[model samples]
Target: MKISQISVFLENKNGRLAEVTRILAENNISLKAASIADTSDFGILRIICDQTEKARQLMHDHLFTTRVNDVIAVRLDDRPGSLAAIMTLFEQNRVNVEYLYTTHIGQEQRSAVVFKVEDVERGLSILRQNGMETVKGF
Candidate 1:
């Protein structure tokens, strides 16, 4: 119903993103999905990984600012308007989505979306009621 996501604050500079990936690779942390939202000064690197706790610990040890939070991973049909349909469900339920990212898990006809919402529990309930399959892990 919920998945752990790590958000790392990165300074907007060359090799900063590489540093994060390098650290994760060195520690064997596999990324399932990732998204970066950036401004002029910094960026938020949001990632879903195979190992959440270890990734967070490694990032912290390497002196990177990181935070762990739960996001809903909803399984969706890989077709037109699939995302719009899900957005409609959330909108009708009054659940605000802060952000979202998509990933495919070895399925050509289906994909999963990770959504960060205002109320995770309520969002999950709404999505479930709407017949959306929510995944548990990356």
Candidate 2:
């Protein structure tokens, strides 16, 4: 129900993002999924990879500021309204979603949503009780 994610703080400048990707790629780290949110000065790069610990260490060794956080991932149908239904469920259950990102495509006709909620355990339980399948490290 919980997976490790590395959040890399990056400067908003040319080659910054590419440099990060290069560092990971050169080290043979494969990113399963990634999201980036930036402002005027910096950005937060969230990445999901199998070698999470190694990724974090590598980022640190490169002098990049990084933090590891636990997040929940759930599998959902690819059809329309699937996301809305889950959002409705979360809303009804009062689960505060900090942030969320989804995989472009998943096994067959499914998609995976990775999220950080205020109460991870509570949110996970709600998802499980609703018969939602949770994804493990990927």
Candidate 3:
């Protein structure tokens, strides 16, 4: 299954990140997981939230550059080599992971990772064949 990730293009400056968070907070949107990659001039803030479409629309209304991307979320065991095992499967399948972020879910001692890959369907297939569980929602 594919998860919706919201990516916001932010200018690299003081309080820009805070501003984004403030907007989301004002709109009552909660972030489940988030990651940011930055350069000298700008940054891309990627987030998974309970209210994805609403968050995207709010960002748009505020004139923040945004886009929705499809990413795969997998439930991983919270132990050494769990991620390495998954990476090996991806390597064997020729799936390129563009980027990824992880979050701990509940009290199950499991980690959830959101992966942005070159091919979503192929990656999902490979993960499934390897007996990995794909997380569907928050």
Poorest stretch of ten by lDDT in candidate 3: 102-111
When sorted by TM-score, best at the front, the candidate numbers are 3, 1, 2
The collision pairs in model 2 are none
lDDT of 2 by residue, 24-136 (tens): 99999988889998899999999998799899999999999999988998887768898898899999999999999997433445578888999989999999999888887
- Whole-model lDDT per candidate: 0.89, 0.88, 0.90
lDDT of 1: 0.89
On residues 19-115, what C-alpha lDDT tens digit does candidate 3 reach at each position?
9999999999988889999888999999998899899999999999999989999998768998898888898888999998898766566789889
Q: TM-score for each prediction?
A: 0.95, 0.94, 0.95
